[model samples]
Target chain A: MSTNPANHSTPVNTAAGKLAVGWALVGVPLAYGVYETLTRVAALFG
Target chain B: MGFLDRERTIAPAGFNRWLVPPAALAVHLCIGQAYATSVYKTALVKHFGASLTEIGLIFSIAIVMLGLSAAIMGTWVDRNGPRKAMFTSAMFWTGGFLIGSLGIFTHQLWLVYLGYGVVGGIGLGIGYISPVSTLIKWFPDRPGLATGMAIMGFGGGALIASPVSTALLKAYDPNSGAQGWVASGDAVGKLFLTLAVAYLVYMLFGAFTIKVPADGWRPAGFDPATVKAAKLVTTENVSARNAVKTPQFWLVWVALFCNVTAGIGILEQAAPMIQDFFRTSDGASAVSAAVAAGFVGLLSIGNMAGRFAWSATSDITGRKRIYMLYLGVGAVLYTVLALAGSSTTILYVALAFLIISFYGGGFATVPAYLRDLFGTFQVGAIHGRLLTAWSAAGVAGPLIVNAFLDAQGKPGQLTAASYQPALLTMVALLVVGFVANLLVKPVSARFHEPRPDRERPHEPAMEA
Candidate 1:
C-alpha cells in the first residue's frame, strides 16, 4: 500500500544504530547501579 | 467490512499517531508521583522517631537515585524499545511499593530506603525516558509540545498524589494515639500496600498502551530536509559520545545546573518557610498544619500547569525565549519574595506559585531544546547525561536554602522572618542563572560542518 520513496529512507535503520550506541552508553552506569544496590542489600543480610 | 478487514486497512506497523501522546501522558502521570514524597515526610519522621536530617536523607536518596537511574536506563529505552522499558518500570515501581509496605509493617528503615529509594527510583528513571525519544520522532515539527504533553503529566503527578495520600492516611488512621496512623506497624503497612496496588494498575495501563510509530513515519506534508535547512539549531545528528565532546554540550549542562539549583532552594523547605512567616507576623496562629499541606497542594497544581502552559508556549516563541522568561521573570519574583517578607500572605502565595511554575517549565522545555540542538538521534541518552546537573542541583539547592536557614537559626530567634535571608540567597542564584541563559549562543556553523575526511562510511551526511 506504500507508494512514496521517502518511506524507504525513513531512518528506521538509523534508529537501530542510535539504539545500539545509546545502550552502550548506559550499560556501564546500569551495571554500577545494580552493583551498588546488590551490595547494599547484601550488607543488610550479612 | 469485518473488524479484521478494518484492522488490516490501517497502518500495520505504525501506531495510531493520536494514541502515542496519551500513552506518554499516562506513564508520566504515574511516575510524577515522586514529587509528592514530601507529603509523607513529617508522618514518616514522627512515626519512626527519626531526625529531620534522616528524613531528608530518604528524599535525597530517592532523588539522587532517580538521576542516576535515568542516566543508566536512558540507553535501554533507546535500544530495547519503549514497550520493554515501560513494562519493566511498572514492575519495579509496583514492587518498590510492596516492599515499602513490608518495611513499614516491620519497622525497618533500610527496607523502606531500598523499596522506595532504589527500586522505585529505577522505575522513575526508565518510565521518565520511555516516551521522550518516541514522542520527538512522532512530532518532529512540534517536538516541544509533543515532549511537553508527556512531561507535563510528570510535573502534575504530585498534584494527584499529595491530597490523595493525605486522605488515605486519614482513612487508615488507627486512632490509638498515633499521630496519623495507629502506632502499630501493621496499619502503616496496609496503607502502603493499598497505594502500591493502585499505582500498579495505573502504571500497567501506561505500559500496555505505549507504542512507537512505524519506521520512517513523518507528518503528511513535512519535509525532513527542509527542517534540516530551516533551523541553524543543533541538527548535526552526532552520536552521544561525539555530543559530549562538543562545547555546546557543556554550555547546556551549565544552563540546566544553574536553572535547577536556583529553583530547588525554594521548593525543598516551602512549608516551613510559610509557617514561620505566618507565625511571626499576625497573631492568627489558626492556619494549622493542614493549611500548609493545602499550600503544597496548590503549588503542585501550579507546577503541573506551568509544565503544559509554558512548554506549549515554547512552540510559538522558541525554547530560548521561554528560558529567558523563566530566568528573568523568575529573578524578579524571588526579589519580591525576599523584600516583601511575610507582610502579605497573598503576595507570598502568588510569588511562590510563579517561581514553582518556572521550575516546572525548565524541566518541560529542555527536552524540546535538546531535540533542536542534537536531533532526535540519542536525545533521550543526551538528556540523561544532562540530568547529572539535576543531581548536582539536588544537593546544591538544599544546601543553599538549609545553610542560610541554619545560619539564621543560630541567632536563636527562630521565627518565620528568618527565611528572609534564604530568600535573598536564592535571588543571587537566579541572577547568575540569568547571565548563563544570555550567554547561550546557537552552536557555531563550524561545529556543524561534517569533516568528510573523518566520516565513517556508514555515517549519514552531515546536515549543511
Candidate 2:
C-alpha cells in the first residue's frame, strides 16, 4: 500500500521514510501495551 | 526568540541526544518508585494497623490519580511545552512528599493518601508525559530508541527506590528504641523530606535540559512515505478527540489492558506471594521473606532494562514482530510459572522478570506506536487518553490477584495455595492478548484524512 502522496513528498528513501520507520519501531511495544491492558480488564469481568 | 524556539533552532552535535534520556530518567526513576509500595505495605499495616483493603487503596488512589492528572495536564504540556510541565511536576511531586511526611508524622492516613496518592500522582502524570512528545519530535528519525531511553528510566525508577527504601527502613529501625529508633512517623517523614529535595533537583534538571526539534527538520536521507508504505500501521494525523472515536483506539486499549493485567498479577504481591509459596511446603523464615522483597527489586531491574533494550531493538525488527514475541513468548513463560508452582526459586524469579520486562517494554513502546498510527499532531493528548488503559489495569490487575488471594484466606494460612487460580486466570488473559494482537489489522485507509494545504503542497491521497 502506498502512503498518501499529498501528505508526504520525496520517496521512502527520504527523511520521511526514516521518520516513519522510527515511529513503527516505537509502535510494536505500543500494540502489545494495548493488548496487555485489554486482557487485564477481561480478567476482571471473568 | 522564546526558549522553546531558541532550543529548537540549535541542534546539538554528537552527544546532544544523550542529554534527553537522563533528564527524562530523573523524573521516571523518582516516580517509578511507586513500584516499591509493597516494600511499605508491611510498614503501613504494622504502624497503622490498617486493613488490606486500606493499604491497597493508597496505591490504587495514586495510580488512578496519575491517569486523571495526566489527562488534564497533557494539553497544557502541549501548549506550554515540557519546561513548564516539568517545573509544575517537580513542585507537586516534591511538595507531595513533604506533605506526606507531615501526614506520617501526624498518623493521618487520609493525609497520606491526599499527599502521596492525589498530589504526588499528579506529579507522576505530568512528569511522565513531559518528555515523551518532545522526544518523539526531536528524534523523529529514532522515536523508538529516543523515547525508550527516557522511559526505561521510569521502569528502573522503582529498582532504585526499592533498595533505597529498604535501606532507609533498616537504618531507622523504629523498634530499636535507640538513638536511630526514630518513631515510624518520624522516619517516614524524614524520608519524604529527603526524597522531596532530591526530586526537586532532579526534575529541575529535566525541565532545563528539555528542547524541542525545529520545524521541517527531517532526518538526513530518510523518506517518510516509503516507510509508511512498508508498515501496515496508520500514518494519518488524528486529533486526540477524533482518535478516541475510532475502533482502532479501543482495539489498542484492549491490548494494553490485557498485557498489564497479566503482569501486575505477579507484580503487586511479589514478595508475599513468593514467601507464601515457599513457606507452604518448606517453611521459609523472616529473613528469607525479606530476600523475596529484593526479588521484587530485581524485577524492577528487568522491567527497566526491557523498556530500553527491547523497544530500541524494535526499531530494527519492526514493532509487529516484537509484539508477537512478547505475546507469544510471554504466554509460554506465564504457563511455566503456573505449572512450576514455586518448586524452583530460580525458575519463578527468572520467569517473573521476563514477564515484567515485556510489561515495561509494552509501556515504553506505545507512545511511538501512537505517533505512528495517529501522527504527532495531538499524540501527547492521545497518549494521555490511552493511559486510561493503565488506570483500568491498575485496578483490574490488583483486584484479580488480591481478590483471589483474599478468597484463599490470606497468605500465611494453609489454603494460600489457591493462588493457582489467579495464575491460571492470568495465563488466560495472555491468550486473549495474543488474539487481540493477531486481530490488529493495519490502520484502515478511511482513517487517513487529507492533509491541509498548509501542511504540504498539493498531492494525491495516500494508499493503505
Candidate 3:
C-alpha cells in the first residue's frame, strides 16, 4: 500500500499561512467598513 | 454530514490561534441582524395595520430570547466544542430568517415573532457565546482583546446588515412612495429570504473553520506565573452554577446592567436625541434625517473602535480599572453631554462618542472580568448568565429614555431641556454601576471545583 503524502501533516510553514489568512479575513471586513463610512461622510457633506 | 463533527474541530499544535477571531466574527456578524430590526419595523406595522409598539415587540422578543438562550445554552457550548455549537447556531439563525420570510409573505405577524424573535434569538445567543470560550483559551495572554474583536462584530453587524437590508428593500420595490420607503411585507419577506440564504453560507465558514485549543495549551513564551493575580483576580475555577452563588457575579451583573442600560438609552435614540438636543430657535429641526443616519454611522465606528481599543487597554490597565473608567468616566461624559449638548454641536458629538466608546468598552471587557472572578472552567456559561444584564437593559434602558421623553412631550416635539431628565438619569445609573464595580471581589473558594484526576481528554486518539 502506498502512503499518500498529501494526507500527512508536513513540518512546513502552515501556522504562518493560517495566521495570514486570519488577518485577511478580518481586514476585508474592516476595509469595507472604511469605505462604507467614507461614503456616508461624503453624503453628509454632499 | 460527518464533515463538521468535533474530531475535525480540534486545533493541531501548529494551527494558528488567530484564525479563531474571524470565525467568531462570522457568527456575530450574522446574529447582529437583531440590531437592524428597525429597517423593517415600519413596513411590518403597515402590513399588519398595527401600532408601532406591536412592530417594536418583534425586536424586543429577539433581544429577550437572546439573553435567555445564551444563559440556557452556555453550559452546553462549554461542554461541547465551538464546532457543534456554531453549527447549531447557524441552523437556527438561518431557519429564523427563512421562517420569518414565510411569515411576512403569508402576512402572519406571530410567525415573524416566532421565527425571528424566538428561534433566531436563540441563534443569536448560542452564536454569541459559541466562539467566546475558544477565543479566551486561544489568547490566554489577551482574552479581552480576542473577545472584543468578535463582540465588536456584534456591534458592527448592524452596520453591514442595515445597508444591505435597505438596498434589498429598494431593489424589491424601486417605486416605493414617500409615506413608505421600505416597500411592503412582500419586499420584507424577500429581504428575509435573501438574508437567510446569505447568512447560512457565511456562518458555515465559521462553523467549519473554528477549533477548540488543545487542553492546557498556552500562547508561546507566555507564563501563567507572569500574570500577578490581584485580590480581585482569582486563580481558581468556578462552575456557572456555582458562579451564580457568588456575590461577585451579582455585583458584576448590576454593573453590566447599569452600563448597558445607560449606553443603550443613548443608542436606542441616538439620532432623535441629537436632533432634539440641538433643535433650531425658529422651530425647524437643525439635524436632517440624512445627518442623523450619518450620526448613527459614526456611532457604529465609535462602538467598534471602543471594543477593540478599550478591551486591548484592559489587557494593560487591568480589567477592573478599564471597567472603572467605563462606569466612572462614563458618568462624567454623560453629564457633560446633558448640560452642554443643547448648545454646542461639537461637545454633543464628542461627548456622545466618548460615552458610546465606554458603553462598547463595558461589553468587551466584561468577559475578561468574568474570567478574573470565575475561572475558565465555565466562563462561557457564566458570561451567558451575565448577558441577562444586557437583556434586562434592552428593556429598561429604552423605557427610561422613552418614558422620560414622552412625559415631557412627544419625541420630535421635545427640546434639549427635555432630554436633561433622561441624561441625568443615565448619569445616576452610571453611578450605580460604578458602585457595583467597586464592590466586585474575587469569587470565594467555596465555589471552586476540586481539581480532577485527569483533565477530560476530548480526544480519543483515533483517526477520523
Candidate 4:
C-alpha cells in the first residue's frame, strides 16, 4: 500500500509531528527492553 | 468518557495510517508485562511463605482469565470500538496492579489472586485484541505486518518488564543482592504501585491516540478486488456469532493449539533443559545458571523477532503457506533436537531458537489468517475466541512435558534422556497441526454475511 499519509483532503490527526511522537512513545521503551535483554544474551557467547 | 466512543475515534481523511501501530503497541507493551511475573515470583513466595505452586497460580489465573475475558468480551469490543475497549482495559489492568499491590502490603494472598489474576487478566484479554481489527482495517494491503507490529509488542513487553522489575525491586529494597536477590514483600508492593502508575499513563496514551479508519476507506491505490483474488482472501463479512459454526475456525484453533503446546514445551523447560542435556556423568552441568538465563533471553528475542519477521513474510507468501512452514518444519526441528540435541550446545540452541520463532510466528500470523478466511467484519471476535486454544495449551503444554519428565525422574536430577519422551510428544503434536493447516479451506458461502452497502465500496457483493 501507499506509504504516504492520506493527502486527499485536509488531514485530521495525521500530521508528521504527531506520527513521530506516537512512534517514539512506544519505540523508546521497546528498544530499551530489547537492549537490556541483549546485554544478558551476551553472556551466552562470553 | 464520550471521547472514548467509536465514532469519536474515526480517522480523518488525511490521518496517517502509520500512527495507528504505535497506539496499538502502547497497549500491548503494557499488557505484555503479564509474562514477566517470574521476576517477582520468588519475592512473593518469600513474603507470603507460600508454596511455589501458590505463587505460580497467580500467573495461571491471569492467563486463564485472559482467554476467558477475550472470548466473552470480544463481541463487546467489536461493537464498542478500540478506543472504549482500550480505556476499559487500562482501567482493569492498572486497577489490578493497584489491588494486587494492596494485597502484597496486607500480606493477603487471595487478594493478589483477585487483583492481578482475575482483574488484570481481563485487562490482558481486552488490551490484547483491542487494536487488532483496527490495525487490520488501516492496513488492508498488509494486514500481517500491521498485526505483527502490535502483537510483537506483547513479546517485547516482558523483555522490558523483566529487567525493569529487577531494578525497581533493588531500588525499593536496599538489601536486594545483585545475584539471587528476592525483594522483600514490601518492596514488591511498592513496585506494583509504580508499574500501575507508569502503565496507566502509557495505556491511556494509546487509547487517546488510537483511531478507527472511516468506513469505506481503503488505502490509496489498494484494491479490495486484488485482495479477493488471492486464495482464501475474502471481501465478505462474517458475524462473530456465525464464525464459530464454520469448520475453518475450528481447524485454525486446533492448529494454533498444537503449535502453542509444542512451543510452550520448549519454553517452559528451556533453562533446565539446556543444563540437563549437557549434564556430565558426575552430575554436574557444563552450562551455568547465568548462561542458562541468557539462553532464555535469547529465546525471547527469537520469539519477539519472529512475530514481526515471519508474520510480515506472510503478506507475500500467504498465511496458509507460512503456517505450513511453521508446522511442517517445526516438527522436523523437534525430531532433530530430540535425537541429536545432546551432541552440542550450539546445535541444540539453534534448533530450539528456530522452533520458538515458529511458535511466535503462529501467534503473529493467526489474525491475518483469520482475516483471510473470515474477513474483517468480526475478525477480532473470532481471534479472541481462537485464543481459548492458547489458554488450553498453557495448561496442556506444561502438563504433558512435566508428566513425561516425572515418569522419567525428578526435576533437577533428570538428564537429556528423560526429556526425549516429551520432545517426541511435541513432534507428534506438530504433525497434528500440520494436517489441520492442510485441511483449512475458505469459509463456505452459506456462512458468509451479506455485505453492508456502506462498508465495501470497492468489492463485489456477497451472495447471502
The candidate that achieves the highest lDDT relative to the unseen native structure? 4
Regions of candidate 3 where Cα sits further than 4 Å from its true position: A1-17, A20-26, A42-46, B1-7, B174-180, B452-464
Q: Mind giving the per-residue lDDT tens digits that candidate 4 earns over B78-171?
A: 9999999999999999999999999999999999999999999999999999999999999999999999999999999999999999899999
List the DockQ of the predictions in order: 0.02, 0.03, 0.31, 0.50
Sorted by lDDT (best first), the order is 4, 3, 2, 1
lDDT of 2 at A20: 50
Worst 10 residues of 1 chain B by lDDT: B1-10
Candidate 2 per-residue lDDT, tens place, B370-437, comes to 78777887788877888888999988998898788787784566223567888888888878877776
**Tens digits of per-residue lDDT for model 1, B1-464:** 13212122233453345566766766777777787776577667777778868767766777788789878777666776666777788888778888877777777878888998888888888888877887888888778788877888787566556556666766676574555443345555666788778777766665555566666777888877765654535656655555666666777677777778877877777666677666634544424556665566556666767887888898778777788888888888888887785777778878888889888888888888877777777788878777778888989988887787787874334565677677777777777777776766665444443545664445433442
Residue-by-residue lDDT tens digits, candidate 1, A1-46: 2447677545455545544543333233223433433343332123
- All candidates: interface RMSD: 13.0, 11.2, 4.0, 3.0
DockQ of 4: 0.50
Report model 4's TM-score to 2 decimal places. Answer: 0.95
Query: What's the TM for chain B in candidate 3?
Result: 0.95
Query: In order, how many clashes per candidate?
Result: 4, 37, 0, 0
Better of 1 and 3 by lDDT: 3
Best by TM-score: 4
lDDT of 1 at B457: 44
lDDT for residue B210 in candidate 1, whole number 0-100 = 59
Q: Quote the lDDT for B4 in model 3.
A: 65
